[model samples]
Target chain A: MKIAIIQFGGSNCDMDVLHIFKDILNVNAELVWYKNKDLSGYDGVVLPGGFSYGDYLRSGAIASRTPIMDSVKKIANEGKPVLGICNGFQILTEASLLDGALMTNSYPKFICDWTYLKVENNNTIFTSRFNEGEVIKIPVAHKEGNYYNTPERLNELNNNHQVAFRYVNQKGHLTNESNPNGSVENIAGITNSKGNVLGLMPHPERAAESILGSKDGLKLFLSMVDYFSNE
Target chain B: MEYYAEVTVQLKDGMLDPEGSTIKRALEHLGYSPKDVKSAKKFIITIESESIDKAKDTVDEMCRRLIANPVIHDYSIIMREA
Candidate 1:
């Protein structure tokens, strides 16, 4: 499956994401800068993690207004898969591609640590390889990762099963200690109403290899490849 | 004419204010009353314009587009008429 990763001016993870797709997954992947509007050939697109525009106004606030996001939004509306990680998640929120917004962490400090995430909804293409309630360890590094949504939207996410991941303890049980950024209901990731777009705060690319600590993140990338291969 | 505008943006009440909480603690340590202190960002902009309406519109646009993320921040503009 061919994948296109969007790279904005301040994007730092485009290379890492491309490397994993090329070397590890052995999939055809290319880095498309923010200025490029052509994305007709790729099977999927990824908004990789980084402090786009230095997180000056707010994380992903500036990057969302870049010219390429318009096309990304168009591609997403067509039922293609779009995965956003870290600041990419923030960008999705800013662009209104995903529901809710990410606020500063309750801790009020930059948090950089390994976090355990529970697979809340494995039925989606992004988590099809994992079982429901499965615990996966991934690294999270961000100052503004706290997710917030209105009451109606939160209920909608629950009823629609749009929540993809939640913070969990080492025993795979949801707990406050495992809530790295104080996200409401310990939410760590969510999908759009159509389930075609995914936004997650953790860095799955950072954990794609066992050398980085765990290979659990590989399942996500593999799931995407598997999904596109079947199509 | 040169007009100076100061924009102050703050988190709405009932929202978690980690930065304000941190600053409040620091003030308490400094032996100030520190009863209630909220933190907000201030932006000072100087614009040359021919009319007040034009300057206000331009600064308002800047606030919405760059100075603040409307999702979280509420900003008030204070313009100094020259």
Candidate 2:
């Protein structure tokens, strides 16, 4: 299945994602500019991490309002897999495709480090390759990744099984010290209600190869491939 | 008529404000007895409309649609004739 990596001005991680899908995974992936509104030919879409629009007006606010996001929104409504990473996650929330808002980290510093993410839900198309409660190591690089939502909405997300991942320690125990961004409930990733749209702060593309510290992130892309193949 | 509007966008109360807290802490370190610090963004906008009410509507719509995210922010607008 062909995948489209949406590229906007200042999207720095497009090539890395392209490499993981094209050279490593042997999948057909192409970088599509944000001005292109047609995504009709792709089976899935990836919004790679970077400071879009120079992170002005808010992390992803300017990029989210671009015309191409309308096309992405339509693709999401059609139930195709849509994965957003780091600043991509910020864009998803700003576009209202995801549920929560990502604010400045509690520490208020740009954190670039490896993190452990517990797979809270394996039922989603993006997380199908992971087992429930599995802990995977991925690297996160961002200044604004603190996830927030109203208490009521947070509860609803939990009840609906939309939470896809949470920050945890090496032993997979959720602790305050492990929450790099101070996100509520240590949330690191979440999927839309239909399970087709997934957004997370971690850079899975950066962790796709064993040389990159861990290859645990490859399973996420593989899960997408399996999902599209079965469809 | 041309109207100008000033919009103040701030994080809703009870939401964590890391930047604000950091500033507050710095003020304390400088020996200033500041109880708290709140941060907000102010935008000056010009809208073309026929009446004050119409300008108000346009500015409000802009704030809701783009300038502010209702999930974590609250915004207020002050409009006047330009």
- DockQ, every prediction: 0.57, 0.94
Stretches off by above 4 angstroms in model 1 are B1-4, B45-51, B61-66
Regions of model 2 farther than 4 Å from truth: none
List interface RMSDs for the candidates, in order.
1.7, 0.6
Candidate 2: pairs in clash: none
* Alpha-carbon shift of residue B20 in model 2 (angstroms): 1.2
Instruction: Report every candidate's CA lDDT.
Output: 0.89, 0.94
Taking all chains together, each candidate's TM-score versus the true structure is: 0.92, 0.98
**Model 1 lDDT per residue over A80-106, tens place:** 999999999999988889998899999
Angstrom error at residue A54, model 1: 1.3
Docking class of 2: high
- Tens-digit lDDT string for candidate 2 (A43-114): 899999999999999999999999999999999999999999999999999999999899999999999999
